[model samples]
Target: MTQDAQKDSSTYWKKSRVELRAAGFDPDRTAKTTAVVTIASAWTNAHRCNNRVRGIADLLVELLAERGGQGLVVGAPAVSDALTQGTPTAGYSLVSRDVVADCFEIGHYAHHGDAMIVISGCDKTGAAALMPLARTNAFGLVLYPGTSSPGKVSFEPWAAKGTNLTIMDYAEGRAAQEAGRISAAELVELERNVMPGSGTCGAMFTANTMSTTAEAIGMMLPRGASHPADYDAASDIHADVRAQARASVEALYRLMEAGIRPRDIMTLRAFENAITTVYAMGGSTNMYLHLLAIARAAEVPLTIERIQEIGERVPLISNLQPHGPYAMTSLHAIGGVPVVMKELLRAGLLHGDVMTVTGRTLAENLAATPTLEEIGKQDIVRPVGQPVAPANNHISVLRGNIAPESCVLKLSGKTLEKGEFRGTARVFDSEADTMKAIRAGEIKPGTVIVVRNVGPVGGPGMPEMVMLTIQLQGRGLGEDVALITDGRFSGVSHGILIGHISPEAARGGPIAAVRDGDTIVIDPGQRTLNVDLSDAEIAKRMAEWRAPDPAGRLRPGSVHDKYVRLVSSAHYGCVV
Candidate 1:
């Protein structure tokens, strides 16, 4: 080893070197003169969405070693909400985010690593990967594993024009099958073809949304959020994904040398830029929770109300997935996320001066990026002047007698046009009961389906009810029925659904006091969610409310119990 490398080598460093040697690494050759880069990922054989990350992590580790740096591969718990839906384990979805973040933090801190590279490809994984880096303000970057290829079926009768099948198609297909709208053979075809390969879901769901937000927040390498996981050797653009990954590994060393940390890039303005992208893309409502959590970790002041305020000024321009008819890859073809960011910048909606992982301001990055017309003609992302939704009120923060602390009304242009919905509350305490009622055809038009006792406190994890919403959509009640919940919804969920109800039911929120036939009003214009009952009457009912026994759901002293004890309200990011 060189004397310069050994100059700062202490007894502790020698001990760490010995441990590295035992792990088959040449510590003297790699670690002695280089920074330690912890390559963290939520990789497992548990699901297709996350399973591909291990390969990316391995490639990064090799790249880091090639650059004379020591790379430590660390794996965190990976959970698939799509696989967990309708199961008891669904509650573990959001819980996994914290666990993954904690796991990576432990690994990174234990090694005293100088830099980090998080490879993630699932709904929660992207945000989970970001939390540790943001909390430590580490010199790092997040690599979205990328969206999967749609099924290669010649016939796509169910798919919208110019769009491909995704996991959501299968989900909605199952709901259609359940409703007898499609034959079993048709559902089987969708099941076989929805997800054809590795990577995250094809839609602009939480995974894609969070990945895009990461780019906008300046946490990801430029154009890194817009690549496909399954690369095509024939296409130079597709092949550049691997090149970008290698480049990002090299950039880490440069970043460490420059003393540019995550906090340097994840500033308040950077976060605002992320929120702007979320609104412009008509991105997932889950962005609200993830952004809130990440902002808290980064020590940047952000709240649901602030997010709402930003949304009010931004417009929804992207037409992709659940509410629209396009895939994430479609945006990729039109020059990726930078196209959307470029358009937003043109409209003066973005913080162009914000720093990014690419060692350039967001404006600098976009200045070199190809525009939609330059790349090719595409309408996947419309211009700011001609937005899909004139107002980005999708994340409408509602406060009234029902949700005093505020809840979220997820809206789209279609739902926004409807203005408001007034209906008799059809209260159900559990998701199962709500699903049962909907499947039984008991849910009627103008019915405000209130699913309570399933919030962060009540669920002890706040499981997403995407399947239930999908069922409602398949049964042709998406617009006809409105569902409000203390629990959350998946990014794939659409319709007149309001979620993340604060001061949740188990804590004796007014939602717990709701009874059948209680009149409820969901007005997006007024930004209010209220029941037609007197405040005194609602308070009286809540006075008699009792929280559910912990043992009745999850075991005492379980992870869920711990989360319940430490987790805050959903509006507060439900951080533990």
Candidate 2:
């Protein structure tokens, strides 16, 4: 090893020793075993969260320990148990930042052993755990709890149960209404019929997208991307977890033997590859920010522009979630993320030479796992030469007076108007306000919905305001309504939703200057978001706008606030 590598290894080992001691372990006498840390979202309240945490824990304890010299350490058993029991614990306490911090803490404690495995399958938790794992550069593997299959599980029970029926309910209700007068009981039953079993929603939400992206990036084993809860495959969840943990350890040992650094496994190219998959899968908009955070942790420069540039060439292929008709279970049955990677590689969209945890080039991994005919027939993954959309259709970075640092928009399935639009800017400072306006019929069709104060530094975490788009659609103005936000949208979000407007209102982005009835135009075909105002008008407004006091931000005086401050102060990709 080079002198610097040797020093780095030594420092890491020392840090591990310190952490282990702090965690109530005897550094000198503790068994030299790999430690696997699993982070799950609060379980009981969210069925998918419960199953994922339980499934991963069950898998790790069984698999790694059987490998002879490995020990499993779950980061938050109390939290896991609470989630499984369905009891409300602390609110907002189980955020992704906490999970990531735990992973780092546990990984450091266990670094002296052999390797680390991360088992997570929630939106923030998955991203958080993986980010720190990348930084540890420890031999790491991720086990994603799969989504439940729609065919096998019955949503009837939940539908029969109760709650505020969403747009889907309304859609079904409309059908019912058209047929005849339906009782309240009938409507409740119908809603439950559509949301069966105990799993995360099948759409391409943050959890599912992160899992698929993890597999695409090589942090997960081939064909490890999806397993529906109702399928026999879900029954083997433990086996899957164990296999992943074992493979992770082996991969780590191979890297150590080859004198490969963590950077070798997690590289700039790999980050780009993962981000591209995130776009293609119609993954989470959170990924745009999460990718930036992960890249920072790995000491890579990943900007909004870089992500948009990559998206320009990578088409949205996964016919899942908010953009398409299928769910994650269908994607898994159709060959999962490996198939996606294979196609991307074939299309020359992904860098085939990138190193993976599997100890093989990406090309080799795909070749070894040919898509089964049954799965291929389902079209889970688009063929390399014939993709769902041409390369780079899923995401775009936009720049205008509104977003100086660059903003992002997912372009897949989006129909843009050829001519410029001049409409009054209907500004809503928060998602709640926007929704209230929509429901109250105050928002007219062809309105520019400016959702401000929800950027990275603004929302604090830049939460996706997906409901705004859904509400707009419900109002029969899906195409006519344009959403301009400093926040983001879910991967399932489509149709003229512009997100990640940088230099957010809190930081004086042009979006902050937009008032109700100000003329705003969006020309996606030309890649422009112009407000009909002169430079002087914009400058004067900029001067007059007062940024919100930092104290007013969400999660104020919390760890999230601290993270925001830390990341904003550090290099762009250093959060991990």
Q: Largest lDDT belongs to which candidate? A: 1
lDDT tens per residue, model 1, 279-303: 8887787888899999999999998
TM-score of 1: 0.95
TM-score of each: 0.95, 0.80
Report per-prediction Cα RMSD to one decimal: 3.3, 6.0
The CA lDDT at 334 in model 1 is 71
- Estimate, for each residue in 263-311, the C-alpha lDDT of model 2 and write its tens digit: 6767878878887777777776667666776666667777766776787
What local lDDT does model 1 show for residue 100? 91
- Assess each prediction's global lDDT (C-alpha) against the native: 0.81, 0.60
TM-score, model 2 to reference: 0.80
